[model samples]
Target: MALVLAAQRGRCCLWALRRQRWNQVQRFVKWASTIGGHNIGKILIANRGEIACRVMRTAKKMGVKSVAVYSEADRNSMHVAMADEAYCIGPAPSQQSYLAMEKIMQVAKVSAAQAIHPGYGFLSENTEFAELCKQEGIIFIGPPSSAIRDMGIKSTSKAIMSAAGVPVVEGYHGEDQSDECLKEHAKRIGYPVMIKAVRGGGGKGMRIAHSEKEFLDQLESARREAKKSFNDDAVLIEKFVDNPRHVEVQVFGDQHGNAVYLFERDCSVQRRHQKIIEEAPGPGINPEVRRRLGEAAVKAAKAVNYVGAGTVEFIMDSKHNFYFMEMNTRLQVEHPVTEMITGTDLVEWQLRVAAGEKIPLMQEDIVLQGHAFEARIYAEDPNNNFMPGAGPLLHLTTPPPDSFTRIETGVRQGDEVSVHYDPMIAKLVVWAEDRQAALRKLRYSLHQYNIVGLSTNIDFLLSLSGHPQFEAGNVHTNFIPQHHDELFPTKKATPHEVMCQAALGLILKEKMLTDAFRDQSDDKFSPFASSTGRRINICYTRKLSLLDGENIVDVAVSYNQEGSYKMQIQDETFLISGEIFNEGDSVYLRSSVNGTVCKSKLVILDNTIYLFFPEGSAQIGLPVPKYLSAVSSVVMQSGAVAPMTGTVEKVFVKAGDKVKIGDPLMVMIAMKMEHTIRAPKAGVIKKVNFQEGAQANRHAPLVEFVDEEAESK
Candidate 1:
């Protein structure tokens, strides 16, 4: 006890010293920033989620106050809590909240903020919003309005790039946006043409039509999404580069007419035309090619007289030949990877440059250091075509963060991944001395990220990172689909040993609870109240039912007097013994299965058992009662249901409308992407449960259907 007390005292002293050091660092930063010449003292972050919190971190470091404007849905978000002042702009929708330019501007004025930082997405690339800031005498921490205007529109940017002698893809950028005109241009460009919105970024309004037959439908889909996201429906048809790699360079400029490039990042692997993983500097890019890419990006920035942080994107074919795609007129979602490689805080640079400072480091002064990788962790089901999900983040745990690794996030454990906005949860970024080491660190970190509430692509990211071709740096835009077979292999039954582990976890947990209850009562040593399956003389046998997906497995356990047990599953028996212990609010199981001992993090929530090991994880479900299962099945089989929670954008059928299988019934928008709910069979619509603009939850019946023959009868 004396030694323990001494150790505790030492820890307390260590903590105090660390706190003192941190205070010293903060004071030093404040003094240094005070010496820097900048008039803006406070800035309003006209955004939400991770980016807002990210900007606040740099702002706090610089001793600048930050004001956060959030929607009603983000009342309890981390960004709101971190801000010096927070205001609710409007309701949950983007139009009423984050994208409401006047409302945000009003908050900036009310809060006495001198600047507004539109942290990407909503108004980051908005030309009018930048112009509004200029008119209001408030600094917009981005490029000039003219630069945003030139680069925000793809046609204008392409023309500027061409005039700047940069290579551009063949596309139709004319003002004629008629269906006939766009179709004709697409035909001239050849089939497999790319339909993209003129004012689109982040793949929100982009589609590839593989053939002429699907061109019109794809065009209409892209236009609708573009209209909803950017409020513009004009599209440009371009030649789709088959299996091209997406590479982009990060460029920073100042009002003093100085610009520099922070190298390039490879964002080739994607889904739904959006990037999943990004790395820098681009793999397999030699020194000469890298120099050319950076120079081209710098030329593009200079052509527009760009300012602040921006990304110049390119599409590279197999021969390493590349063409300009489009320039993002603001800090990108994947800027952390570039920051990690270059050892620079891009957001801090944005603030300083926006304050009329010259480029901190010139082109020759900047240097690249290590390799970095950033994986976007999102709330989506990889098995269900990556459909986005919205729910509470019930149990969230992450790898220990260090200088080499970072978990950039906005939501806490109880916060919901809202249905009204993007489903991204966090970004996992890591850095190392080389590409191979960085890739290994990424996989290691992913294995430690465990989530229980909603479906995530963590496991899928592991598979993709470890794939052979990915390791060889042979990645393209079609990496996921091209390697689908290996990435998504056939599911097999739960291994018997794993099943034994699950059963042991359940039994041990029960024993712990029973012991706790007995200890609290007068009958502390009552064997009758114990749930350990202990018998007086003979072994006690009990049957356990566990669900793996839709299949149920039966396990027979015989408890021995020696505290070990024999679990039998389909003619195989194993000796298992385990104990449940608590370690810092988390429950863990240490089990010896057939003389092999292993430990795993055990989470039993909502009738499911999650076992997270060092290398892999397993999910076992508790069988639902028969009555409850029957009720759910009936509700599910009633009619076609919403695949996810979303707002109904368009409904094609009312009551009594007839439709066949695969017929488009309605269009729903969720997570800024469009999805079409189709008919499951030929039937007459009995009821239209959801109307246009109505929000529908997952598995809710959208359109009740009855068979035509049954209706006639």
Candidate 2:
């Protein structure tokens, strides 16, 4: 009893000390502000989507009026609905709306906004915009314009960090664009070097040069992308940090020359340099390393007299050595994880700090509580190379009983997933006592998440969360590509599982027939009679299996409504609705099988289904009957097409242009990656549908692939 009392006293003492330290930091931050009261009023948010909604939530909590500026495409957006007042800025394209400095400023003035909060993207990092706000006497709820300017250029930021005694990856940030110069730098830094654009972000204008041959090809590609993206052909070469963990520290500063770090977040789980999953209190970082990282981040922030919220990103090697990468002088997409663990509303802090209020907490007062994880749910198809998917979102439902896990979504059911901007559908965040617990929560939440009418990467995220290495907290930069086969294994289900599914389908079909008969007549029919009667017809189809065998199964299905279907085999009947496929054709099922019933989750390829069985799991291809067509136009047209997912850097043929076989049609840019579309056969461009800057969907026609030769002949 005495020992327990002592332990409790010790914990109380620690809590008091933490509070005391926070008070000191707060005192220092608010030394000047204490003379005045908190007076920040109306704030204009210059962005769209969930981020705008997220900032508005904090503003409402602080009793501050938030005015949202939206584009024509976002007039019905959730952010616009959440704001105290909303106004239209421009058309759908980002440049004319969210990125328009004059329009945003004009809206702020008209709305009587005293402060402007640029959330994450768009004009968030535009130093010119920040300076304009400062000149207009409007508080920019972000870092100083000078800080943004200094960090906007990768070369200058690296120089700044290096001067501040922060380790930086050895590279050539010089302005020389000669191939010889780049080759020499690459050789000196080693073969596996990364080429990047100085004025670009979001993984754009970046390429990995592994060998001599790859160097030349990547150099040209990088230049082309840089020229098109930032209108700057200058590139920087840096040594690739092999097997590195991407970790960043969130820091805040005040005009009183005081700053504090909020620990670190692990953002190594990325796709094409864009983080997909992030977690607070980085998985493998220990206390000592955390302290060093935090101090370094604070020093970097202090070097530029940074005010407001900013993040200092670093790449840590296997040996725990880290190098400063870049600083993002804006609120990050993954800031919710930090908020969950620290109990601090960063947007509120930004407002308070911008109002000349000091940070009320000291570094020592900032206590690391539990672990938190964030997953970016995007309207993208992971199986289709992470292409941006677009269509009317028929359904957008999140996991129920939002406990420690929180969902932040901008679009609801009936909303359109347009190709006008980023494909981030929502952000799902979960918190727990530790990393493993957080992972478990995240996995469960992902499993329960459902988004229909458009493809998404939810299943991929679930698989990544459940990955052995990821759960073990041992993943690095190349984790995805290294384990691609294992992560997305290609295997066929056992014959017995197939038989069980068939049996279940049969049973379901019999039940449906009996139900229909009973509904039509007063008398009920037995299950045995229905199964034995010639009234029921079974269809069989043969498909190639992954295991070098053939799969044959009987498909029995019925329609509950237009475009909605239910398939039955034996005792198991799978309920499938939304976007129906070919009539009476065998379709692959990707589902989680429980006992005699298999739940259809994600439909993989047209013919492949991921199935969860009672005993184990398997992938089974549904057999298409011999009477059915090998290729069904119904199934092909039913699938959602990718639009504006890729960067259309160039459109070779214009409308009514004469062309030949396999001529380059257009290009699509996505996730900073580029893909080229070509003509199918010899033909004249009947109609060039898309323009250079206009984005295209997967099935959206780029150009008519008519056979010109055939027409001539």
Candidate 3:
């Protein structure tokens, strides 16, 4: 009566054990009869973006129709289109839409949904939300409300882990949240302690204090972030682990008290305490240690009666000593890598367990497969310290998904990556025969990914994948800091070859247009756009202006004959030749600059040209004459401007406030990361132009500075 693989059994006892699945099915039927006398019929996903889509796919695969709820901003979203039915919740802001529990429940009830799958973030771990779903007679596709309550708070979870015989990091998880009390606890825990939000995950509301002098400030920052993100300022302290690897075990459980561990994933290579890349099988893990970790995770799950997909995260040191970090009581962002290695659909498992069914596979039946890795593609500029960018995705290209690779995304070309949500564009996953093969596939895939319109971290991801240390698998949580230089080398100046290519492309384009008009014009004395609609002479002596960050280059192209031109950069001259073709919105250029032939995918939008090749990318801006573009230019600022487009969240000073270098002046939040703007030098704040909660643009001055000499003048 049960459907399991033939490989699940190697002996008669195992077959006998599987036959007991009939009992599990009978138990589920009795329980279902008490509830609604059915399996999951119609389900509602109480979330948005890629996660919503992910849950819908699994639901459809199981013959269950899905409903979607969307805000005004997401009416045209991909998930809304993919769902069987959809309802509008509220405005764009999450508080009025995604987090509106009553509205979501109303929609679910009106749609006659039997279960609500709170996919990952919004209300997924909220105990009150889970309980309300149960009270409304709708299945909450997650752990019981009791488990969410215990593990949702860090302080309570640590106590629970300790009681369950799981190792915990030594620190204070107390009721007193006073600053002075927290400082004392940090002192006792010794310098370099981790101050974390009691209810935080995903790197928000976490800070590391190095010593006594900096502890209070760091604690306040952590609390502010926590309060803004989670509405709770409760925090806990922990002894900081040095260069520890972040490894987590994937665990599943059923209502029949059955639990199993899938495997472990190494998420050590992270930035800002959040994982950007992840892999499964946790390279170099001791077989015995892996056994212990799996046992411990299963034990932790049973202690809380966890029923669903959960991740038991741990911090392992260089000596392989591991401690419980926290347990995410839902599917994780990096769950795909685990799926790739185990050949398991974690979402399907979540659905079946939520329906009171037993796990299809046991620990012995689940065999590990090849290695896999996941790279999180974000709309961020890594060279600018990973400043998030929000805009339309003008051009998007990615490697075609195959058996060995998968692309998980929620947005399409021309969709706007809103600033209100996480700026992750997609997750690129790859698998190969082994770790080294997988690493090689990841690098090749990154090269195939080409994006334009907004800044992205594709180049940075490529650099990280190619780094010898990363390729060698010598990874840690502090891997970025350890190899920042190699990971993010200095942006080399635009090569003369590339600049020459740009000039040739522009010149050839102009000539092609002229020839086009000459051929199509009816009148002889005028161009196509003129009243005569006739051929007209077009100038070829045009300047190709290129700007790469602060460095700018200008080249002039002179026509020699048909399809030939001479390019001049500075005092040097080169016989540069090239051909450009316009295909859809992309520009392809094949040019010879100083005897080196180069071919590149080029994108020219307004005053900028983007070149993406196998080696790297080049963003060069074309500037008009000084007189033509004078009104649009900002006279160089002597003080700080908004580094990127963000909301001015806080203002610590006003006009006439004296500040020293490195003093915190304001806090600006963009793409979900808070960046504190500090005084650039010892000066007086001349004026604060933007008020709190105001939108600030990149290079828009927020604080004007005046030195003593300027004040005297």
On lDDT, the leading prediction is 1
Give the alpha carbon lDDT tens digit for every residue of 1-713 in model 2: 99798667656744654564466456445443442354467899998888898888877756679999989988898999999999998998777898899999998889889999999878898888999998998888899889998887889999999999998999999978899999998998997999988876777788899987789878987888887666687889999988899999999999999999998999987887778989998887889999999999999999999999999999999988999988999989999898777767787778878988778577887877778999999988787667766777764556764546778877887888767778888999997756777788888788667665667888788778888999999978788888887677664546544544433433344455675776777544534344323243433221222321364554455544342335554466555432112222222233223334344333233444543332333455555565675544332221122345554677777756666655666666754357666566555555666678776655655666445455577
> Candidate 3 residues 4-116, lDDT tens each?
43233323433443444344446445544433334587899999888899888877766689999999988999899999999999998788999999999999999999899
Model 2 lDDT, full chain set:
0.74
For candidate 1, lDDT tens digit of each residue in 98-183? 98999999999999998999998999999999999999999999999999999989999999999999999999999999999999
Of the candidates shown, which would achieve the greatest TM-score relative to the real structure? 1
lDDT of 3: 0.84
Every model's Cα RMSD, please? 6.2, 7.9, 6.2
List the candidate 2 regions with Cα displacement exceeding 4 Å.
1-38, 401-403, 491-553, 556-647, 651-666, 670-673, 678-697, 700-713
Q: Order the candidates by lDDT, highest first.
A: 1, 3, 2
Candidate 3 segments whose C-alpha is farther than 4 A from its true place: 1-38, 511-520, 524-543, 556-587, 590-598, 634-639, 690-700, 706-710
Residue-pair clashes per prediction, in order, are 0, 33, 2
